[model samples]
Target: MLINKSFANQAGVSLIEILVTTLILGVGLLGVAALQISSLSSNQEGLFASQATAIAEDYASRVRSSKTSTVMPNTNISYAQFVAAYHNGNNAPLACAAAPAQLCRSDAGNAALDCTLAQLAIYDQWEVCSAAQEALPGGLVRVLNNGIRLTIVVDWDSEQGREDIGNVAVRNNNCSPLTGSNTRNCVILELVP
Candidate 1:
């Protein structure tokens, strides 16, 4: 009778053990969830970075293929104009194997103009200027006579109603960075000719 009574008494888990197990399981689950969230956020951020890089490169290529004089300092190539010019092949003489305008054609050679200064490499954002307010993304220019440096900047937040995408210089050699998430991806391109 005593043995049977003792066995019954110890048949189940102790309250402290159960509590510890519950606490451990809860903590582990929370950690896993935090990890998942962080991973997902990182993935999204990577995608954004990729897109920014693509935009920057596209901008660089467009500038490369187009006539440099058209986009020189004090010129007024609006954002729309820039995009249109990029898509339209920049009036470059199409090669024999030229594809349609909608397709991104390659300009392996045949010559192209280089960028000028105000083309700083630091403050990397696209800007355009208007008569009333020059807060656009195309007013910045670099003045380089012997050599030219180019940086392609992407404006991911501009289309989303953000206010921090329009004040980068062409060279950006000396500028302070803003205190927030990065607003641009600057690819440095240099030309000497």
Candidate 2:
């Protein structure tokens, strides 16, 4: 009878253990939530870097294949003329390859200057810049021609939560940040295009 009476008086101990277990479980869940957030942010940063690199290379390839100064029989314009057209930025976007104007056509049937060489350069630029902006955030391209060499700089707005992305060197090389709000990421490529 004495032992039974003592056990019956200890019911409060079970309630205390349940409360402690619940507290520990809640803390563990909170930790997991924080980890998930960090992982997502890191993944976004990686994606931005990859996009910047690919876009820069795409423009480089286009410049190479569409060289203005080819000596082949099919190419009528000189390289100098092509470079000048690109620098002037006068060729507005158009469906040059279509009929009537027929400004751009690489097929064998097309005659010379169907689409002026400058028109081709402008079209290529628009295609590249448009693709970059669509794929990445606040994307911009800067092309510099220094007579002997060409530099292509691809810029995009830096993603938030990336403290290491922007530095003094990036600012020095690129005049503006990727976006107005944060440090801009710069992908610089040097070529003889």
Candidate 3:
């Protein structure tokens, strides 16, 4: 007869070792999940910023194209008027086939019929605000005129990291830097058109 004590002592795997391995793997997986969540939040913020920029540029370009005041003194169309139209707090519903919603429907390839300069100004502002609000969550548009300069401000709310942290206190201090209490984001574009 032969004695094999070493072979009997060596088991396949200990219960403590398996549990420790599982705990380490779980912790690693949790870290990966947290990273994924953070990446998504950052991506969403970038998306909102891009949308705001595009909206601002669209209005700026349109205003530049129609800089001349072709109408009379009472109906003179200017960028200032367009900006005011946006901030006037008038929520007139827009009905058009385009994304920005044109003032009048163009027939096929022909130009828009019976569209006046004043109408164009109002339409430009309406379209800009509509597109901005539709694209960004809790969107608000503001225009500031400083003699020779114009600043277009777009504000929107974000839920990034809010789910984990809690409710954030957003301040309306003219779009300044957001602290731990602030959750909203603002995009500012200044143009002299």
Candidate 4:
């Protein structure tokens, strides 16, 4: 074994060694910065996911609260009549059908074009029955209505890929997606409390 020189005894790193170390440090620093960026992006997505989940749960709870009194807005028509009109095989008049996808009174979204993450969230609802949701009352009126179903669908474009995830029906106190010129998405939740 040879004696080793202390750092004080050694004058300094050779130029070649210094260059190699600098290259290594530079690469390492870049890797760390990339990790930081990725972490921030992941955190942002988690926050959005939490917010979307809260929105979904809120609507679900609202449906549960008003299960018995799912009265349609039109006073003279009556709940049964509106529901029957809603459930019929033929598309109810445009007065009822919500928006794009032309899915009776429910699939309404921001506009004919938007399809935003928020809009997609409500648009993806599915029904429990063999028929389309349009064939049922535009909203789920049960706390855990087996006859109706909802799916909160969210989508966004990112460098990695397109993201689309949804939660199955959650009980609601009432239906909502209330008043708007762009009522399709709202109609999806309209009846919820």
Residue 187's lDDT within candidate 1 is 26
Where is the poorest 10-residue window by lDDT in model 4?
A: 178-187
The clash numbers for all candidates, in the given order, read 22, 5, 0, 31
Residue 99 of model 3 has an lDDT of 43
Where's the lowest-lDDT run of ten residues in candidate 2?
90-99
What is the TM-score of candidate 4? 0.39
Off by over 4 Å in 2: 1-13, 68-113, 159-182
Clash count, candidate 2: 5
Better of 1 and 2 by lDDT: 2
lDDT of 4: 0.35
Q: Of models 3 and 4, which has the larger TM-score?
A: 3
lDDT of 3 by residue, 1-193 (tens): 7869988779788899999999999999999988997676667677878998898888778767656444234464555565554333332222323443444335468577455555676667667778877888766666666556667777677654244534332444656542122566767788877
Model 1 residue runs over 4 Å out of place are 1-9, 67-147, 155-193
In model 4, how large is the Cα lDDT of residue 147? 29
Better model by lDDT, 1 or 4? 1
lDDT at 132, model 2: 66
Ranking by lDDT: 3, 2, 1, 4
Give one digit per residue, the lDDT tens place, for model 1 in 123-153.
Answer: 1122110110132221122212221333322
Q: Rank the candidates by TM-score, best first.
A: 3, 2, 1, 4
lDDT string, candidate 4, 1-193, tens digits: 6767575488867899989999999999999988986666666455444443444455454333223233333355443442332222232211213433523233346233443322332332322211222222232211122123433222212222212222212222222222111212112333312
Pitting candidate 2 against candidate 3, the one with the higher lDDT is: 3
